[model samples]
Target: MPDRVNDTAAAYCRIWAERGVRAWEEEWWLLARDIGDRIGRLINAAPDTVTMQPNVTSAQAVILSCFDFTPPRDKVVMVDMEFPSMLYLYRRWLEGRGRVEVVTSDDGITVPLDKLLSAIDETTLLVPVSHVFFRSATILDAKAVIERAHEVGAMVVLDIFQSIGTVPVDVAALETDFAVGGCLKWLCGGPGACFMYVRPDLNRQLQPRLTGWLAHENPFAFERETLRFTTGAYRFLNGTPVIPAYYTCQPGLEIISEIGVPAIRERSVTMTSYLIAEAQKRGWSVFTPTDPAQRGGTVSLQLPEAATVCERLLAQDFLVDYRPEAGVRVSPHFYNTDNELSDLIAAIDDILADMN
Candidate 1:
């Protein structure tokens, strides 16, 4: 966690106690606006093209709500390796409205880009895929996906929950329709701080049901008779904001902004490469891609009794997570040292050896 995060969050609480209701208008709301601006800068998006979300699920809900699922454009394309929450949401929501065609990953390790591209056709309306897959950590070529989707008149929604702070992503360069990510993981910010970026051009055309005062152009005018959303990304905003979480999130985003994503990606690739080699030598089944370009910050390992092993590792304060499909995932961030990883592997070696 960022050293300043606790201090920042505490300061936010103090503001609430002392200033009370005035803090919303006088101070807290300004921080809310800055969260959007910072997220816009994170993805190289132009100003006014980003907005805060309590989480990526909410951001996705808004994007999905905007679509009509009309005659020909009634297909939504995704992949088997997508985040489970999103995959489940799409399956439930798109059941009758549209068909969700999920392209299967040949090996659980990597998803073939060609397979995903082949799934996109004239009937497809939107393609929401991960920028860096949660399970395998395979990095998709979103630029290529965007180009292909545009040919068939489909919008692309890129989820960067596993990529934003660790990988280099420029929405302007990629020309993707939307990008969403949260600060919970690499950013060291706990939760309730996520963002979505809308292509400025698409903002005017979309009218999402998930909206509030922030979405209105003239909110103070009280013109409820005719509903009108703002021209740019502000239209994506909905309901009252989460203030304290943004305070905790601000420090992490600022730290990431200071260090930069390119630098972070370089460190991640180098560390993960070394870990992959070490894992292979130890006879562990590595699920993450060996190629740095196709990899993210995580190294997924398939070991016997992964869930039990993960529990043991957690007991020792070795922080890593287990996914049902991916086994135990060891992610080394820029803040982590090479020695720390070597120690982790050494411990894992001992623990697994004991198991046998």
Candidate 2:
């Protein structure tokens, strides 16, 4: 596993060394733009329909703020298990203006698409959902939710942060109005570099709340009163991009693209299945879905001393993320092997046995 990390880093270094810092400069911004376009294509979206943002949170805010919330259509429907940034931002936005109805989940952790869809009506302006629940690794039926929302003339926004590289997604096929994801988690891109896709039809109807020189139609023209915006997804971008962060994502995105999302999804399912089976054998409570189709790459478990168990796992050189309420979360990428999952399970068993 350490060798894999080193190899990944070396691959990135080689690419960056060949490209050089100058390759990421102005006019060369097209390099980053092209990579983003390729990613959109990979997700079955038109190349011209995607925008680059600093992070998913910023993209979510931009999409939410762009809509003009009026009377009956003022509500934004979301699940309670949404990421903290999106949850807080929506709550703050709805504080004085309108209501943000959080649809109740059967379990507090996993959101049922049917329940979420039932909450949407003619009054609903937007429906925001995570493609995969960050903690439980439960994959949502985005196609069904998007179709139902459109029936009521409501827009759907999806946060693909947890599922992008680990699961197969087609933004165009799902017909979502907006989707946001970053390179940090599954994409392996450094923090602060992310991508957003807006449907072409909605491009003209919406305006960016956070405008900057880059979003201007003629950024170099320096016109004060005549601030024209770009026709497509470029309008969503604001300010100068982080060149280093942008460069860092290029290699990772390229790798994912080369391997193909479908293949990665298969590999992830296999890894999670093995992990879950092994954990359950040791009497650990499996929190994620047992079915492959309904799950993402992450496999979560509950233990009496979850925090302590996670710390002990970390000491054994096992890397897994922990959520306070969700217990321990283990996400194995496509690069991770079944042997690694077996080792992880043995470590967990040892930790639990020690507690006993």
Candidate 3:
């Protein structure tokens, strides 16, 4: 977390006390829009293509709800390596409506591009996959995936939660139909600061069924007779804005924007390299991809009782997470140093030996 998060959130609270409910109309509400603009700039998307949401799940729901599965284009292609929340969400949505084809991982570590390409045939309507595997820390060739999806007349819905702050993403260049992510993890923003983005051209072509009053062409005109949706991306604005989340999230985005993904990626590579080397030296099985290009900011290690090991690490003030299927995920950001990773590796070495 950034040092200024407290101050920023405190400022957010002050606005609530001062402006009360009128803040939504008077001044505080537009911060929500600016937050969209800032996050849009990070992903090389136009401001109009982005809309802030409470979380990625809600954003994913909105994107899926916009699609029509009436005709032959009734298949949703995904992978076994995808984050479970939306994966299950899509799986459950396939109840008599459409087919969900899950491309299984060959080695349980990575989902090969060819597998995904094969599954996304002409009958496929949407390919909702991750830019990076959350537990495995494997980075997908998103550009290639997008190209393949478009080739078969399929749209791509990329969940960039694992890659957004750790790697450079150009949605405009990738040409994905829809993208959803949150600021909570690597972006360093707190919860409730998630966003969903659509291509400008797609926005004009598609309309969302799950929408709110703000999505109307003229929300202020209050025309109750016609419930017309807005022309651009505002069509995806579903409900009341998570305004307070806008304040706490703005600073983290600014910090990341100033540093740039390339620079953060450079530092992250160095840190993870050191981690992978030390883990190998200790005879620990590494789960993350060895190639930096195919990896994100995290390095995963396989160990017995990973949850217990993670507890020990947390007691040592070494921040990381434990996943049941993939073991421990050690994520290093711009703020983390090689020395910190070295200390963590040493701790893991001792912890593993002691446990055995």
Candidate 4:
């Protein structure tokens, strides 16, 4: 977590301890909507159409629960390059509900666009895919996927977990039916703060079985005769809001909102391009897309003994992560400088040299 975010978290911890029961009605209940509105601008969606969730997987669960998974539309199409968590959730949820058809990636980096489109047939009920691939940071063709899914009467659910804060996204332009993302990555909102976007029209239509009292039209009324869901994105939410997480998320969201994603994206593209160029110059394989248009904020360097190198980098207080096939991932955000990236590459070289 960023220091500013941590500071906000600490402030909230004090508020929770100091205010106690008085805070809930006064301000705690409003954080979800406040955060949702802030998140809406990031993705180019209306504020009311977005809702706060515990995580992306929870949001996915709510969307999945909305459908009956009946015949003629019992198929869910997705890409192999999507985050494993989404796949895991869908596979387990659909085991008894429906079936999942994953479009395989030819090189374990980018998804085959043609194959992905072909797999979304008339029988397909949902097409869930990542806006930017988790491992390689490859930006998917969201508009094309949405178009194909619509042609077959299938709804497209985009997981923008990797792209929302760093890459430019217009959910309205893409005509995506649904979108889910978290503040954990580029948003810098830290863990436990995630959001889901439902189209205004779709918001009125979905009745999520994975829901709780908070989603009720009159939650405090405690009426159990007939469950009346609240209109708008609130219907997607389940259980009490994670207040502390919401509090911590504000600093990051405020920072990103002020700088604007377009500016951040430009910085990200430049820095990641530099990272890719530097890695490639050393005869290392770059797993992320070479084209800035096809990439997000991250550049994955396919290094020899990458796992060991990543361990050493962490030991040196260099924060980077390693994935099995993607190797060492270096994500440079708007706050990062070109010199830091260069120094990081140098550090990698030093680590590799020591190993040899």
Encode model 1's per-residue lDDT on 1-356: one tens digit a residue: 89898899899989889999999788876566688888788889888778788999899998998988886899999988888889988888888778999999898777788988999999999999899989889899888899999999999999988998899889999999998999899887878998888898887788998788878887768786877787776688878788888999888889999999999999999999999999899888988999998999999999888998898899989999899878999999989998899989988888898999
- Pairs of colliding residues, candidate 3: none
In order, what lDDT does every prediction score?
A: 0.88, 0.81, 0.86, 0.90
TM-score of 4: 0.97
lDDT of 2 by residue, 289-310 (tens): 8989889888888877899989
Backbone collision tally, model 3? 0
Q: What are the per-residue Cα lDDT tens digits for candidate 3 across 233-291?
A: 67888677877688788789989999999999999899898888888887888999999
After superposing all C-alphas onto the true structure, candidate 3 shows an RMSD in angstroms of 1.4
Worst lDDT 10-window in candidate 4? 1-10
lDDT of candidate 4 vs native? 0.90
TM-score of 1: 0.97
- For all predicted structures, in order, the TM-scores are 0.97, 0.92, 0.97, 0.97
The 10 consecutive residues of candidate 1 with the worst lDDT sum are 28-37
> Taking the tens digit of each residue's C-alpha lDDT, what string does model 4 give over 1-356?
66787788788888889988888987898789889988998888986899999888899999999999998789999888888888999899989778999889999989888989999999999999999998999999999999999999999999999998898889999999999999988888868899999998999999999999988999999988878999887888879999988988888888888999989998888898888888878999999999999999888988998999999999987789999999999988888877787789889999999999
Instruction: Arrange candidates by lDDT, descending.
Output: 4, 1, 3, 2
In terms of lDDT, which candidate is stronger, 1 or 2?
1
Question: In terms of TM-score, how similar is model 2 to the real structure?
Answer: 0.92
Model 3 lowest lDDT segment of ten: 24-33
